[model samples]
Target chain A: MKKTSVFGPTTALAAMVANPLAAQDAVGIDDKVNQVFADLTGPFVSLIFAPFPGTSFPWIVMWLVIAATVFTLYFGFVQFRFFKHAVQLVKGDYSDPNDAGEVSHFQALATALSGTVGLGNIAGVAVAVGIGGPGATFWMILAGLLGMASKFTECTLGVKYRNEYEDGTVSGGPMYYISKGFNELGLPGGKILAVVFSIFCILGALGGGNMFQANQAHAQISGIVGDYPGWITGIIFAAVVFAVIVGGIKSIANVTEKVVPFMGILYVGAALVILIVNYDQIGWAFGQIFAGAFTGLGVAGGMVGALIQGFKRAAFSNEAGVGSAAIAHSAVRTKEPITEGFVSLLEPLIDTVVICTMTALVIVISQQMIINPETGSYMLNEAGTAIATVDGNSGVALTSAAFASGISWFPYVLAIAVVLFAFSTMISWSYYGLKAWTYLFGESKTSELVFKVIFCVFIVIGAAASLGPVIDFSDAAIFAMAVVNIFCLYFLMKLVKTELSSYAARLDSGEIKKFTH
Target chain B: MTVKLVVGLDGTETGDRALAFAKDLASKIDASELIAIYVIEWSPFTFQTADENAKRHLRREEEIELATSRIVEPAVSALRKAGFNARGIVRHGDVAETLDKLTVENEGSQIIVGRASADGFTKRMFGSSTQNLVMHASVPVTVVG
Candidate 1:
């Protein structure tokens, strides 16, 4: 029995021999798996999500909601109380040049609006309607209205915590307010938060405010002049931007003061003409917007989806609770912070409510007139869809198409408008970015010159490179700034209240009289 | 050949110092002409009706000129008192741009300007508007802090 146990001894010997080799192979597999995982965890994640967050929910919309809610409650609805006064402020009724600032109230508002009223109104609305349908317009308008309060809160705090230079210059913005306001309130981590906000702001100004602007402007110019190359457009844009920004705030104000209103009126006038031409369809367009908002039409995932898209687009369009505008407004020449704050509220109203609505109406009416054979309904493809075969390009292209439908040679007109909007936006943003850069690096001639050069270079790069991902990340940074800024505003509401009351008392006592100029 | 001396004033401490320096130089050179220039950087008073604010702005300008005159005029008087020739001039724009224009207009004039404060970033970036005149002006420039 011991001798003939068949193959038992042989099998035992084979098993012993194969064990080491099998163990080695197993170890090799484990090592490979770990290497793959590390690669996936590192730059891969950033690359994939870097262009935009890879999430099912709209993070920007969520941030906007949180900002709106916090500011609304903290400021006690100051937007409504000061609506009339905000108009007065814009009219220069309370302008005082001796105040601790540089530019006028009107100039400050123009500067801030130049930041908010750029490609967002042009391409952002188109994106919304394309993805979410006409229903999204309703949600967008609502979000913009709420954004006014947020702007008020942030601008008020900006003035409250501004610093005065010994040479009679002034510096104030989220960088100063977040840290100083919190320090005044005895907050434990205020400085850290303030630094964090400044870092985000600087990145945002460079990416969203600066590069994005140059890119959009270059694209528009290239689109308009078939013979013109993008680099040429970028170079020229950079040169003009360099000249204006090099001169600092005074130059920026001088240029924006003239450019903003002219461009705004021109764009709005064109849209108004289109709207008037399609006057008959206006009622139906409104009906469709209202009806589609609640009971989403043939689109999949219906009402909830439509609402989400609308609010997201509106939030992106006006940048209402985003604290970026407050930085520009903070530089206004006035002792009372509330004066600038009032002017700030008009941004959302103009950018989202007026400009965005016009774009939305044009798209809606145009879509209604162009019937889709497949669905027997107005073509959604023309509005915006990922499908390449769609009737029009998304965002700016869709708006251009809408304009073309109503007027002959309209594409050229829109192309010019796009370039102007983008140009003004870039110039204004350059100042914002420069200030932030100066805040981070010391404010030396070399520092300023260096920032201006880098900024100019990015303008070229933005013109040439694909910005889908870069813009997404920039937009996110901007929203993140809003989150930090609104938090600071919430804590410092008491100071805003005190300033407002004092300003109001001055108005009542006739100490501050309206100026006719 | 008649020698001309031009001094820049903005009513700052530096400007006061520059005026005195220019007066002494004008007297030493026995110059035929002495010009004291003040550049007004746009008046906001035109936008305001308040007398106090307007006076405050005007008084500041006047004080700058008065101080400048007190330094230069006395020197001019001394030059005349000593049987020399002298004159005064004022203009407006950017300080540097105005100075360059003034220097070119009076090509043979020797320019005197205040030295910039090396204390802070603002002063450094702004650079005494006077230093700019020295760098770009066609005439010889002397900086006095």
Candidate 2:
């Protein structure tokens, strides 16, 4: 075990763990767990993250970027062209009172945004800027803009091919679209592709959605309260999640829905305050972003490195093409399938373009990152991690340090935000996973319970142990979903184009009435 | 002159008293009518999960159906049987806004609504729907105690 810091908030439990005897046992268990998962998931992780031959770029990132670009062109820059209409749709300006029973465009957008706008904005951007330098922010914004097109295509397809049950509930996602959309096009492998996507979705929910979130939440809490066994936090979290998901305690869920958004606002508000305070540095920060994009600020691989990190994190952050947002959007009540698509494109804008940019700016402006005056690049430690002025901080800690620089009490606020973000993410992903589970096993109460139990168990494991391979596998599973989703989107692009054209014609003809001015 | 009194019903004893008062007032006036309106209070502002959002429309529909059947229909039929021209309206929105909007739509000259005991903290702090309607309704509002 690493030596406890002199000024660390070490409780009795922490002190006991710091004792050599207890420390050895804890390390032994962690090592054993890591060894098992790493060995098991090693090949799959390598295959997923494997770089292109003679380059550091992961092919999956290229896959998403290429697909997003194609959709942008094919849809005639739909994200930009329909931007105003999208806002109108969200504002209930075009929503007929007769169509009031289904999910509002605003609610669907909010639900989808909640799922995407969590740790990726907070920690993921920090990681991107820390390693890839300020240049990553520029590429992140560009990638986010392109991602809106991807969101447009998938969500349009999702609503076009959703399953409406007798009881009024509906389900849709890449799995539904891939299967039904391909079948409609007289393709044979739609079912198989959908099954593959579902399997990946379930795993992604467990690893990235559950485990990674639990791990990060624990990290943030421990940073504030004191170091202790992570299982203590995990068990407490699992109990609460269980009460919400299994026990059907809607009060907890309701409070969370209200609270999470407030937390999001608080986070953005804090970022804005910090940015406004450093009014002079705003220009210099943008200069760093622009300069670093091309020149790399002396970082390795420079521009290319920055581009790769930006694209990867933006894709992960907004999840524009991952098809998860499609499931949420599919439930909206609209006569035209294309309206939800318009509404969904704003998700990437809000998540990556607005929120993620705030985080990147705060990190860039705060100057927590140590730069070598001579080399004009970030100073690196022995492990090659970007050494912050705080010393040894990275990820959320680096972000915390950056925010704490401006507001001394920001870390406490950040800790609350992180925990809330993690909790909300887990709740959202549990629903996503349950949907996938029911699709595969046929929607039975027992099957859903099984998945929820397994998910909560994984949360405990995630918090208790540091399993790198497991997290890697979780990330791979999510991108693996993108791999399947984007490929299917290529075949189904024509359907979306036709729908958009028809909707546009009717809209121009005033067949679709605006309910509000 | 035809006087249309829009009465807000909540399927409570207080609502019955409001309807009875509206009926008595209409009886005393020539060519008067009673429009029983039940507002299923709802706001689009509340955040929901994907699953809950998916089912929101159905829930709203169910609420409308229930209110029409249980509250508005029964009261309107009774008013009709008592020899008053009556109709029922049910909508999902804020109570004061929906009631006032329904009144204006029907060209109502007066709004009659039951004033339930406003005991809750939020009600005390922000004022009840009856208070809101009396303060802001376009037509005259009668708060039946």
Specify the highest-DockQ model's number: 2
Q: Give TM-scores for every candidate, taking all chains together and pairing residue i with residue i.
A: 0.68, 0.94
Instruction: Spell out the clash pairs found in candidate 1.
Output: A51-A469, B34-B87
Question: Whole-model Cα lDDT per candidate?
Answer: 0.65, 0.84
> Which tens-of-lDDT digit does each residue in A382-416 have in candidate 1?
33332121464566777777877788687776676
Give the per-residue lDDT digits (tens) of candidate 2, residues A455-485: 8999998777666667778888888888898
Chain A accuracy as TM-score for every candidate: 0.82, 0.94
DockQ, per-model, please? Answer: 0.04, 0.67
Error of 1 at A369 (Å): 7.3
Model 1: which docking level applies?
Answer: incorrect
The most accurate candidate by lDDT is: 2
Q: Show the lowest summed lDDT stretch of 10 residues, model 1 chain A.
A: A1-10
Each model's total of backbone clashes: 2, 2
Clashes of 1: 2
Best by TM-score: 2
